[model samples]
Target: MRLILLGPPGCGKGTQAKLLSRRLDLEHIGTGDLLRAAIRNTTPVGARARPFVDTGNLVPDDLVNELVAERFQRTDRPSRFVMDGYPRTLAQAHAFEQVLAQWKLPVESVILMNVSDAEITRRVTGRWSCPTPNCKATYHVENNPPRVAGVCDECGGRLIQRADDNVDTVRARLKVYHNDTSGLIPYYRQRGLLSEVEGSGSIEQIYASILGILQPQGG
Candidate 1:
């Protein structure tokens, strides 16, 4: 089913998106990956998008909206896609609504992974990343450590703390998430499309919680 998985950074949106995509047979679309792929493929849009992305800011609305438009237009497209990181702001959400209406599609669900600020800080600040450019596989110092200490199991790359994964930055992100996303909750709820599931359990349990919310009405 078409879904928007919302959460603060490190609230497990990516993991839940993967699970939901597999179970529901929907494409898992992440905005960061979309921009990076566009840049890698050297689309004209990518050339224009690089500077905005390099600064860790949101991509310009025109560029990102066009990309999402392109994505939703592909043939053999599933009826549903789980978007992990698009439509992050009110502008993007408004743009997305226009695009979806033009395409005669409506979002099926807006899913939020509810987590407390303290838990977010605990999970995010403990993350370590592989040094390889664009390889974002993360390890937690306690929950999901590497086979060997301070080394990536996949590529043997050195693991470093992301510049934005520090306590201060994560706290700032949570503040923004709460402040910005609070309104969207009411926006989606009015449409009868919002479903929030606790995301702090085991992966399977969290996935099941989301799946129960998303199952088709009669299926």
Candidate 2:
């Protein structure tokens, strides 16, 4: 079940990835977590990524590509995995292709979660998170609000909306996402491995759709 999940910010890629990984018994490889672990372990790649990460700048495509390569090249590398938040651009996708070829771990499917920009804005802007270092619980205004408004039930910490989750920032992120994926989506489609799933439905509904695609009538 080697797979890649792609979507704009706030489209629930992470949620879907977790669900699919659990149900399919596949390791979930998320780039953000990958970078964080690399940096925490102070690996050579982490050292190079720290500056950009510290400054809130996007890591170079080559460096991110290397991170993915490093993981796949490991002797105990994941044999079945779901990749999320990776190969974000065409260049990264090509780099990943080379790594997959070298490792003989061709991806079976690439699922693109499609949601409107307006829906993304509403989704992101409605999120609030507990800022306590130990209790970083998140909540969505409509989907899962706290018992008391603006208060964390577990820690009683005042919930704060991350700057990146603001409407303007989310819109900007969607724009960048569209630009990067413009070619990436087509590349996968041409390879006959792309599957588009509507991302506006409930999490279970979306997960069911993905399962249906992965496990068709006789597949």
Candidate 3:
């Protein structure tokens, strides 16, 4: 099963993808993680993508598509994979279709994890992360606070909220998500591959909903 998980920031797309990948034995491919790995390795595509990523700008569609294509062309690529973040815009979606066609990989399901903006704000604003470079553990003030306030349980490092996780920054991200990524909802729906799942629930609840949608298709 080739699956796509779509959602706004703080919508738990990554968490759900990880769960689904483990349960279904599929590769969990996150575009952000892939870009970071490429940049760390200094690949040709990474060299082109580094500037944009470092400057907090969106990487060009062609460069992102190239990264996706490279992943698909790998000899060890998994037959089943769950894509957490890619095709964020309509143009990227179309470019991704071309890549899929070229690779002969068809998407079996696209899950849209739907959550309200208010809920997104609440979830994102509470997020805090460890300061240690290697121990990037995360905590939430409300949902999963550390034993000691502002301290990382694993590394004993101070926990600080990321600049992008601030309420104002989260709002800006929400606006961009609505402007750029929402179109893909309709794009996938028209193809009869989209499944809408309520996202404002427990992790297991949301994962159960996603599984219910995909199990019928032999996930």
Candidate 4:
């Protein structure tokens, strides 16, 4: 059940990926998570990626490809996985194809979660989180505010919005998404591997929609 999730930053790709991975017993390979882990651990790739990350710039295709390639080379490489936030560009798509070919674990579907730009902006900009190392609880301004205003319900810490979650940054990220997916979406569609899912609904509703797409007929 190798899958690829394609969507803008605030389209709930991460949430859906987590749900699908658990339900299908597949590895959840999120490039964002991997990059964060690398950066936190100060690995070679992390060091190289930090400058770009700090500036809210997209990491180069070669660096991202190298990082993903290393993941695929691990002894416990994931044979069944759901990828989120990866293969963002045509170059990445091509490189990923080669890697999957090497592993013989071709993607069965590419889910493109669609959300409007305005909605994306709203969703991202409303997000706030606890910065405490032990409890990084997240909340949305409208949808899931903490019990007390500007406070973490779990840790009683002041909530902080990520720097990249600002409106301007989100708009920039969306532009990048549009540019990359202009090529990526077509690449998958032409291969008969693309599935479109609306990302505006509740998490469960969206998850159900995806399950309907992936499940065998009459299963």
Query: Best-fitting candidate, measured by lDDT?
Result: 2
- Clash totals for all candidate models: 0, 0, 0, 0
Alpha-carbon runs more than 4 Å astray in model 2? 132-137, 152-157
lDDT of 3 at 77: 65
Cα RMSD to the true fold for all candidates:
3.5, 2.1, 2.7, 3.1
Instruction: Give one digit per residue, the lDDT tens place, for model 4 in 1-219.
Output: 999999888898888999989999989987878789778988788889899999999887898987788778778889999998888898899999999899898989999999999999999999999999999999999999999999999989999998888989999989989998899999999999999999899999999999999995725
Give the number of the best model, judged by TM-score. Answer: 2
Query: lDDT of candidate 1 vs native?
Result: 0.82
TM-score of 1: 0.81
Lowest summed lDDT across 10 adjacent residues in model 1 is found at: 70-79
Per-residue lDDT of model 2, residues 175-206, tens digit only: 99999999999999999999999999999999
Candidate 3 vs. true structure, TM-score: 0.86
The candidates, ranked best first by lDDT, are: 2, 4, 3, 1
TM-score of each: 0.81, 0.90, 0.86, 0.84
Off by over 4 Å in 1: 42-44, 54-58, 74-78, 129-138, 145-159, 216-219
Question: Lowest summed-lDDT stretch of 10 residues in model 4?
Answer: 210-219
lDDT by residue for model 3 over 10-30, one digit each (tens)?
Answer: 898989999989998999998
Q: Candidate 3: misplaced stretches above 4 Å?
A: 40-42, 53-57, 130-137, 146-158, 217-219
